[model samples]
Target: MVVLVQKLLGHFVRSEAYCLVNGKDLPRLDINSPAIWKASVEVGADTEAAMSNWEPAEKRAFRLGARNFYLKATGYLLARLPFQNMTLRSLRCLSPNAREEESSGSELRCLDMKLPQVIQPGDISMLMDEYTVFQLDTLESAENIDECWRAAFDLKKCDGTTKYPILSKLVKAVLIIPHGNADVERGFSENRRLLQDRARLTLESFNGIRHVVCYGERFDSDPSSFTVTPEVLKVVRNSKKRYSERLALQKEQSAKRPREEPEAVPNSEGQDLQKEVETAKKMLTNAELLIAHGLKTNDLAEVESGNSLLASGKSRLEMAIQKMAGSKNSLPANDLSVHF
Candidate 1:
């Protein structure tokens, strides 16, 4: 049991790019894509002969565990396979004309991209030669690869025309691919669940429910900072009471699956960034709603309140930026990506 667990876990711990999404840095094609391809290549290298008297049952269990993870990671990567292929083709060296190569890893052979007339093959080559060398040089000076990659895209030349437009586009496309959708996918999944029971939910109802959930979370995280509204308290307390009663009843009545162990939580810096980002979003939405309502009713007070919200949102954003600047070694996840 222990050996099987180690073998299965070893693959995942190394290939965290399968699930950890880092929006700030550039994507390494060697690491991010074709996880199963690498694993399959490796599986044969580790034979049953290495382990004395390895039984068929043990082999079956190991294979099952590995395959389960392999299928999920590969499926996720393959779904975005075209994007991954094009990114590789774009970034690789010029001599081999990846389009012409038989071994070009494109699962979908045709990129079928409507190429922008401005960005030609020559442009890609020139950028690759210059930018790749510059990125490499940055490696010598900077402490790590990540710091160097960020420095590579620190665009300074902002004349009338955007500087290195084509390169910037490529960087955004390739570099910004998430290590994993671990953080972002949950909200939408919950949204679907929230709406499942109600077929006729209006836009207002949808937004309101979402806000309640969001506000509820914020309130839980820092009770001192969050305004404790009576309505929110009543709803939370009542909901908790109901849920506790139901959960206990369900456990008594039927078969209960063991609770999955919780995943590792991000550090404090990350949590703060996430909170500020959410606060900023909430404030912006409040501002929008106020302004819209004020316009509809021609109410001066409501408009004034909205302007205040806009200011508050800006302040939250600035604070988040300050936190980032303060903690370079342990900077937070990209929260601004959610909004703009």
Candidate 2:
């Protein structure tokens, strides 16, 4: 009974027809109603033939029972189901095969009405054009939801610019909406197992473990069933080199930290400080690339190493900034000393 009502509500929310739930058409699950039951079930040739044998009192009882059931079902749904706002109903426009008549300019215009910050009024025309092109050109053979959006995104205009930029943005925003709270639930489960008494792990290390577990699960459930490809072997081999580089970078940066804050520096030292800053920037860029690669490959260890390297580079950069600040502060003093 609950499931049936939920399905009906889902249909109502997704329905393109405005004012569907209003007036006499509101959903009511009165399965016990004698007329409805007779219509739904296998019966004699005619409606009169089907219920002719029932006593008048029995018929009245059945009608009363159906009324009570309808009230109960309505109450249950009212308590459980979320109130459907117009914006949620507007999502039908995002559907791959949503017709032009169904998703007209007026309907699309209403999307930004509730949330002006997200969907601007000016974006409506471009979004409409993109959606039309998506329907006509891209949606014909698209096998899946993602594919339908991807094809629309790849469509090009006459001048070679992207054909559906606004549509693509809309699709991306919709795609990121979590289908359920499964991931959040799983995170809590993972935390419970990892955070047992005395099993202390740094935040970075804990995250690395979670990533590895997630990566493993994506392949196969059993650890032994995991297949290590050549690419995996390559990453493993370079892991030591990456770790060494991180350590060296950290050591170098630490060594360069001003022990006793230098108040002044000569022109040569100022030039050297600028050079160090440039070098730190380059190192930071490399570290960022390393982190990107790790994320692309789902390698948490590599990501952690990259993070360490990035921190080291940031420290080096700060040191260079300090030197520059001190140089500027003592410039007048240096000039006066040179004159004496």
Q: Which candidate number would show the highest lDDT if scored against the true structure?
A: 2
lDDT of 2 by residue, 210-235 (tens): 55566678677687877767755555
Candidate 2 residue runs with Cα over 4 Å from true position: 1-55, 97-173, 176-215, 221-340
> TM-score for every candidate vs. truth?
0.25, 0.37
Candidate 1 whole-model C-alpha lDDT, 0 to 1: 0.50
Model 1, 265: alpha-carbon shift in Å?
49
Poorest 10 consecutive residues of model 1 by lDDT?
Answer: 105-114
Candidate 1's residue-wise lDDT over 33-62, tens digit each? 344234432344546456347777877677
Error of 1 at 17 (Å): 28
Total residue pair clashes for candidate 1: 5
